[model samples]
Target: MDLSNIDLSKFDGLAFIWLDIETITGTGVYDTLSSPDTWFVHKNPDVCEDFICSDLKNKQIFLITSGSLGHKIIKSIHHLPQLHSVYIYCQDIARHTPLASEFKKIRSVCNKTQSLISQLAIDVAHICVNIGDQHSRLNKHKQALVWYERAFEKIKQHNGLTKNEFVNALKSKINISTLECQRFQQHRQQLGEGMNEVKYQHELLRQLLDVPTPLSSTEKDDKHIAATIKKIDEWERKNIQQIKTVAERVRQQLQKQINEINKVNKVKHDFRLINDELRQRQSEDDYVEADLQQWLERLQQLKHQLETTTISDTSQIDVQITDDIDWSSMVKLVESDVSKTWVRTREISMVESL
Candidate 1:
């Protein structure tokens, strides 16, 4: 795909492309098509190939091509997932039928323009139905609903569809929309219940704010308390050592950057000569306005050099620390009986589900 030609702002979900040597501007085909949002016509086979390949966003492509060029383009692009269907438009349907039969993407070979238009409309509706079914199978409810709506609209526009087909498509769209609304209502109710539960929990925690003597004097309790403190102390010491090592490494890097800065200072030393010359000229009253302007230009050049100067092998370093702790598991420790030996918490629910 030639990604440079794509404008994401003008993205389309579907494209109708006609590839023929004849110009489509004056032809009735372009005007007959219902959706012109992403319609395209190409006289050159190479340009058609480029357009088909450039739609990398997986937009469905319905291609109408002359029989002479159909075989060439189909062989190259028929396997593409986005090339949904192809139709052969030529004077001799018999000649192209044998060729079209070889490819599964070819819907039909038609000689009459009216027949081609009717078939195209029918295929478009069916395409929407198939796409909607695929999305439904994948559990993409919102996307499925969108496709179903598209299908229903297409069916309504074409009278060739059977009464049952039109009614069924409408029902599918309505059912999906109804189910989506029910899901949203359930989600809102769940959120409300969760909020109430959180409020209740906070009230219970607040009641214990002034309470005391919760733990009885027992050796088991003392041991557990000491063990928890010991665990925290070990964590503190380990993290402190890690931080100190990281600090020392950063200090070494800073020293190297300072060395680079010293090199820049050496370059600044060369500018001192110009400064001295300017001072000498001023003191001796030997400088004209032009001389002052010349000296000012040199100073500007020196300023530009300093501002644009970059130090090699010196970039800002960032420190990243990873912490993996099950905070919920820690809460279990306070609730556990200290009389029994401490058992490390295991996230068995997640493992069992997996």
Candidate 2:
């Protein structure tokens, strides 16, 4: 197949390529991704490599491949600067995880098709955010603003992103805009049109900052804390219900065992009555071969019952208690590196264990 027919440069934003040993269809992977910006290449690692080298040399590439093909081609293509990220799609995630660990560009090893699609969307958004971060660090305010806007737009489009992720993306966009506004202020005296640009940026920032409502910082914090407490309360209720269910089951089992022991005790109580009958028969001089035989048989039966009825040991039943969750960590929200957007950032009051 001629790779030259497909013009990746025609696309304004990102480009993705899927390389597998066979054509992938009906997996909804193609449908989930933007089809116009994507290409499917099968069974030709050499051609795929050449296509990236010759045609996609200038453009950044996001590649997805089967575990076997990825293992075969990763060593050859991993060094390419155009290869931004690689996703390994396979039936066995554990089998491919070690291979992914070897390459930083290998973002995730996804066994489920939906997981791959979701991760692709997230990685694309994060790439944009990271690109914006790079431009910001280099003091290129205008370029940084464009990438940040792209990131925010992508975040909004992809529903896979959590509330905190969306908010962080917005914050990054706002931060870059603030920097650009400050830069515009410094040059407003020299440039005649700088004042107009400043006004526009300020207005944009105002709209971006208008999150939900016009609440004060303290008010927002209080609202968030209340919501966190509510979530904790819900968790506590669920765990308590589970504990109650387990305790009831254990209590019922113990009762059943106790009932079996009570039956054995009743048989032992009947032994005294049999002895009284034997004593009465002997005192009354009721001596016969058949009577003696019957008495002996009755005594043997009672003795056998006592010897065969074995009670289960209660010590074997045990309750295991493990406290593995750190609930307090949820209250403290620490801001970390947002550039690694693929890594799900821990938010305040997130009970990840649950």
Q: How many backbone clashes does candidate 1 have?
A: 0
The top-ranked prediction according to lDDT is: 2
What C-alpha lDDT values do all the predictions have?
Answer: 0.69, 0.71
Q: Could you tell me every candidate's TM-score relative to the true structure?
A: 0.46, 0.43
**lDDT for each residue of candidate 2 in 27-111, tens digit (9 for 90 to 100):** 4545445433556465778888888877887666889998988988899989976777899999888899999778988988988
**Superposed model 1: Cα runs more than 4 Å off:** 1-12, 25-37, 165-170, 189-354
Rate residue 19 of model 1 by lDDT.
91
Q: Candidate 1: TM-score?
A: 0.46
Report the C-alpha displacement of residue 186, candidate 2, in angstroms: 12
Number of the top-ranking candidate, with TM-score as the measure: 1
What is the overall TM-score of model 2 with all chains considered together?
0.43
lDDT of 2 at 247: 88
Instruction: Name the lDDT value of residue 158 in candidate 1.
Output: 49
Q: Give the 10-residue window scoring lowest on summed lDDT in candidate 1.
A: 345-354
